[model samples]
Each structure stands twice: as structure tokens, then as C-alpha cells.
Target: MEPHLVTDERLRRVLDDLIRREPLFHRPEFGTTRADFAAMTASDFWETGASEQRYDRAYVLDALEERHQDPPVEEWETSEFSCRELAADVYLLTYTLVLDGRMSRRATIWQQDPDGWKVVYHQGTVVQGS
Candidate 1:
């Protein structure tokens, strides 16, 4: 396999790690704090949710907090992991999330910082059925 392909597989593993550890970061009862999000995202990050758009890191944190306040949805399957290197140590990871028998397209950009990989942006668009 080519070197970039190898790197992509490795990055895919990182995403897998995130999903497998959702009880830590994405669960409500775990009580993930805003400071934890601050550490996970870039300073200027933004994200699009199922119903709202947050244009900066603070707004993103607010959105996350709001979501965490609600009961968690633990039944979801993620597939189609694709990664593209955007720049040195920056990459885009895209996948499909299926929940409630509905699909959503999701994308997240991760930047490799000195501390670790921080998500700089993310978007999740619901796939409407005909």
C-alpha cells in the first residue's frame, strides 16, 4: 500500500477510537464539561448540527452543551470512513451515520496540534428520504 493510504488507515483508527470511547466524551451521564470540548476543538472551530449551525468555537461549545443536556441516543452505526489530507497534519474525515433507520452524512476536520489531534470543524446533514 502507498504511504498516504497507510496514513489514512491510521487516521481512520483514530476516529474509531473516538467513537468507541463515546461514553467518555459524548455521553450525558459522563458529564463532559465545556473545558473538555475546548480541549477537543480548535480555537476557531465551527460545526453544523442536525438543526443549527454554530460559527465559532464558543458557539460550538454551546451547541454541544445543549445536546449533552438531553438524553443520549446510543443506537447509531457509523460507516464509510474516508480521509483526505487537507494540509500538513490536517485531514478531513467523512462518514455516514445511521440512526433510527435514517442516514446522515458527517464530516469532521482534524488538525494535528502539538498536544494531539483537535477537531477544527464538523458538519452533519440529515439525509432526507423520498
Candidate 2:
């Protein structure tokens, strides 16, 4: 079976769902490997590597989860999405999350193939003190 030919919009939706609908605390994408299923299966922040070498996903989530703060809404907003760096099967997506009315500094990267798009890497930063 072939994967769906996902557009840049669909790709963003997938990530939005992952962040909005799931237990995930945060997410972001890096400029490293998103092709390895093992890498994707596990979170990146738990591993060890240089700031430029490691692209961890779980680490970002932990950061968010650590934030005991509350927002008016917990849903994420698609501030901007671009595929200018995407190749045929690989692409990068940057998202700004807004939860409970508070804006979250989060970014994510997605990979597409015969299996559609999956969360490869994600990082959430604090854009505001809220």
C-alpha cells in the first residue's frame, strides 16, 4: 500500500493533532535524522548529543509537562508552515502552540513515505513567561 500524498497543510494538521489531542506536552523538529523508525519511536531529549547533533522530541515534551502553568486553552495554533526545505519524502515544519490562550514556543518536523506522516522530532521553547 502507498502512503497518502500529504500536502504541507495536511502535514501541519497531523502535527497539530499530535500536540493538541494527545498526552504530549510539547513537540519540535530538527535538521537531523527523521528516517529512522527507532529514532522516531523514542523521544530525542532523553539521549545524549551536542546541541547541534541531537534532535530530541521527548525532552521538549518534558519541558512542557514540567510547566505546571495553565492557559485559557490547551490547543495549538498553526502560526506558519513552509515546505521550502522539503525534498520528495522529507520536510520540516515549525509550529507555534497556544494552550489555554497562552502562546507556546514549539516547533516540529514530519516525515512522509508509503506510510504517511509521522512525528520525527519536536522541541518546545518558552516564548513567554506565561
Q: TM-score of every model?
A: 0.71, 0.43
Best by lDDT: 1
- Assess candidate 1 and give its TM-score to the true structure: 0.71
For residues 7-124, could you state the per-residue lDDT of candidate 2 as single tens digits?
A: 4565565445444422233233421223333344433333222233444555544434344344223455545433323555555555455555555544445555465455555555
lDDT of each: 0.68, 0.44
Best by TM-score: 1
Candidate 1 per-residue lDDT, tens place, 4-39, comes to 323355566665644543322454443467877778
Off by over 4 Å in 1: 1-31, 52-54
Off by over 4 Å in 2: 1-76
Local error of candidate 2 at residue 116 (angstroms): 1.3
| Residue 105 alpha-carbon offset, candidate 2, angstroms | 2.8
Per-candidate RMSD, Å: 5.0, 10.4
